[model samples]
Target: MERWARELTARLPALAPDRYAVARPPAALAHRAGHAWEQLVLPAQAAARGARAILCPANLAPLASRRTVVVLHDVAPLREPGWYSDLYVRWQRAVLPRIAARARLVVTPSAFSRDEVVELLGVPADRVAVVPGGVDERFTPAAAAGPARAALGLTERPYVLTVASRTARKNLGVLDLAARRLAARGVDLVAAGGDRPQFRTEADTAGILTLGHVDDALLPGLYAGAAAFVLPSLYEGFGLTALEALAAGVPVVAGARGALPEVCGDAAQLVDPTDPEAVAAALERALDDPAPWRAAGPSQAAPLTWDATARAMDALLAEIVA
Candidate 1:
């Protein structure tokens, strides 16, 4: 979400200096307080700025605002029961439907998510736009792997990588079986990303090497060095890391479900996320024959840039204000 907000807002303003402005809450007031600010303070601030239309980059938008364009990535939180905190589930249940009904436009990252919005939120098809996230230029085939490999103590070893928070919906445990299966072959299944407060999943991580939270600077090297990248996420609005891996010229094996297949197109080896054996087989295929995937990566990722996302967003913003 932060990437979505930061990347789009970073580019949108430069397009029309006088037209776009961003409103932010203090960094300290991050989660709940930030939500409060967006509900109570942001609308008034938008009014003060004489904003014609406010773009709420994240899922939620202030109901008080008359003209609002909201970007709802997915409805996974609302779909699954007992996965998230009761407070969060209730809040989403109440707010998302309202946003769907009221917001002038609701942007999503993929056609799969657009369909989810139309079905789950009951929003009309015309109001939803698919503006997928982009891979930064830094992630490339030539990125130096030594520093990142040494940092993570992964030097001289082949590893399959996945970057995701240990949330229930991420299906983090699915890869543990695959990790153990691959261990015999001298390949490690490594995971980056830390835990979040909103989730309560007790996913056992006995097989995978958990790197608490990797530095952003090391990500490119990490992706470029990996033998293959796998995301066993049950639902993904947009598989950014998978795309990043593709951009970095690594083979990808992602969960066949959700937006991953759409994002990966034919570049990645997609398998059933729930079946560990299937995931393992796909990873082996990727590791064994990486040439095709490596060759296909850049071409697949070339068109999905931040500039393209911003251009699509610019069109949407223009439509809303005009």
Candidate 2:
């Protein structure tokens, strides 16, 4: 959402008729227990002072906004309640429907998510607008691939890549098992993201290189050099990383769960993220069938761009304020 905020602020300066302001509540508080109450109070107070409408990227927000638009990323917690802890699951079940009812409008990242929201939250279809995300032009086919390979010492063996945080829904445990199965066959698995300790212990480092983070300038080269990109996330609103990989001309293998299947469409190899064997088999197939997948790469992510996403958002802001 930072990317969206920055891009929007850049696209339409605050000096325009509608002032663009992005505020981050006390982060330390928001992550802690009882912090939502303490952290939200200020934004609730600020909502009245020229903050005509508030846009929430996540389902929960300060309930005291003047005119609100809540962007429900997914209905995962509501649909698959078991996937989350009891407190979190209970929180969403209690709060989301209330937000949906009270918000002036709702926004979601993909059509799949929109449908799920309607089904799970009982919001009408017209209430949700599907404003898909976009890719950075930096992650293009023309990006330098060899430099990242050399820097990471991956110049020799072919490596598959995935970029996901250490969240449970990212399904890194399944990828770990798949890497173990592929290791006996001498295939390399390189991942970028996850906690430092988790990557150290969980990832298959035999031929794997796990960097917690890299400079933005080097990220495109990393994407461009990969044999393929894998997104084994069990749930996603819109798999932006998958789109970035496709934009970088890297063939994608993502889980069919949530909006990932819709985002990847036919450009990716969809697998059951819970099945390690399936993930391993899909990885093997993606590694072997290079010609067909690579041929479909350039056009796969051609439709979405930040410029388009910004325009859609701009139009939404105009409508909301009008």
Candidate 3:
């Protein structure tokens, strides 16, 4: 969400300097003060400035603000209530639908998420716009993976990677059998994300090396050094991590469900996240012969740029604020 906001608002103001201005919460209060600021302070400030429209890019928005164009990044809490705590899910169930219905227009990251919004939240399809997320320019095929490998202490063994949090919908269990299978081949399954307090869950990380919350600067190197990147997520709004892996010239094994197939295109090997055996087999193939996937990845990722996403957002802004 921070990435999307930073990339978006960075480009948005340039697109409409005369009309667009950014209002940031105190750096200390960013994540800590979202709800209260979003509901009460945001709309009040906008109205005071007489802003024509407000682009709430990170899902949550002021429910009463009719001029709000809220971006709903998948409607996951409504779809997967079991993944979150009772308090979190209850609040999501209450606020998300109301925000979707009340906003002037809704923005989503993919056609799959747009459909989910329409089907699950009863949002009109026409009201939701598809603005696919992008990869950073720095993520490209590395000439030498040794430095990155040594930096991450991954020089000892080749590893298959998954950049997902320890959440149920991430389908980390899909790695249970695969990790064991790969370990037998002198390979490792390395996971690089952590859990949230609102997440009422625990995953068995047996046979997998869990590196909680890898630094963002190390991500490009992490993706580049992997023998293969796996995204066994049952669902994704935009599959941004897989796209990054592709951009870094790594073979990707992603779930066939959600927006992954479309986001990955023909660059990645798609398999069922539920069927552990199939996902494992696909990962093995990708690890063994990464040449084809490596060749195909950059081209597939090249067109999905932050500039393009921002341009699309600019077009939408033109519509709403005109």
Candidate 4:
């Protein structure tokens, strides 16, 4: 959400400096009190600025502002209730409907999410727009893989990589099983993302190197160093990591579920995330002979750009405010 906001706001000034300005909450609001600040303080600030319309880039928006544009990434609370606590899900269930109802427009990262919002959240389809996520320009094929491998103390041995949060919905357990299978065949697995309590015990298992929360600056090289990038997730709003891997010229093996297939298109090898054997087989194919997939990756990723995404948002905002 922060990345989207930063990139979008950076481009907005170039597109329409006179019409749009980035409004940030005062530093007095602590990071822990972000929800209260969004719900209570943000709208008041915008009103004081005499803003015609406010664009809330993150999922949560002020329900009191009727002219606000809300970006609802997904209806995850309703779709995968088990992934979140009861209190959190209940809060989202209560407030999200009101936010959607009062907002002038709802923006989503993918068509899959737009449909999910319309169907699950009872939002009108006409009010939703699919802007799609974009890959950073830094994630290019030219990134040097050697420095990243050396920094991580990785050998020249081939490896499969996956970047995602260590959550149940990310299906890292299935990736672990596949990793164990691949380990016997002389291939290693590297999983990079923030650690979660639910996956702490699983992270200790051998044959899989869990580099918890790698720096964003090193990600392009990390992607380039991998023989293949895997995403064994049960669900995703827009599988942005898969696109990043493609942009880095890495072959991808992604789960067939959620928006992965839609985002990956024919660039990635799709597998059933729950099936460890299928995941292993796809990884094996990418490692054994990556020529075809490597050739296809950059071409597949070429069209997904932050500038394009920002332009679409700029157009939508213009239309709403006009």
> Candidate 2, which segments miss by more than 4 Å at Cα?
12-19, 26-48, 146-155, 176-186, 195-209, 213-217
lDDT of each: 0.88, 0.74, 0.87, 0.85
| Residue lDDT tens for model 1, 1-322 | 7788888778898987777988889888988899899989998888888888989888889987758999998898777857788888888898899987889888999999999999988999998988888988999999999999989888587988999888888888878777887798898888988888877665757778889799999999999999999998888888898999999999998899899999999988888999989988888888889999999988899999888888889988887788
- Model 1 bad stretches (over 4 Å): none
Model 3, position 25, has a per-residue lDDT of: 69
On a 0 to 100 scale, what is the lDDT of residue 298 in model 3? 92
Write one digit per residue (lDDT tens) for candidate 3, span 1-322: 7789998888888876886888776566655476788888889899999998888889888986899988888878888888888998898899999999999899999999999999999988888888899887878887456665676677568899899888888888878899999999999899988888777556666899888888787888888888899999888988999999999889999999899998999999999889999999998898788899999999999999898998888898888888
TM-score of each: 0.96, 0.83, 0.95, 0.94
Each prediction's number of clashing residue pairs: 0, 0, 0, 0
| Candidates, ranked, lDDT | 1, 3, 4, 2
Range of the 10 consecutive residues with the lowest summed lDDT in candidate 1: 198-207
Residue 261 in model 3: lDDT:
96
Question: What TM-score does structure 3 among the candidates reach?
Answer: 0.95
RMSD of each: 1.3, 3.8, 1.6, 2.0
Tens-digit lDDT track for model 2 on 1-322? 5455556556654335455666555555535443465236646655557677776655566665537777777778777665667786777788888888778788888998899889988989998899988887898878997787777666556678888765567777787666776666666677776453211234333434567666557778888888888888888989888988888888788999989888788988899888878887888887778667776766878888877776787688778888
Model 3 spans with C-alpha error above 4 angstroms: 30-32, 143-148
Which of the predicted structures, 1 or 2, would earn the higher lDDT when compared with the native?
Answer: 1
Tell me the deviation in Å of residue 60 in model 1.
1.0
lDDT of 4 by residue, 1-322 (tens): 7678888888888888898878777767754487788888888889998888899887888887898998888888788888876777788889889999999999999989999999988898999999987987889888988888888888888888999887777878887677787888888899888855423233344667888888878899999888899999888888889999999999999999888999999989998999988998898888888988998899888888998888899899888788
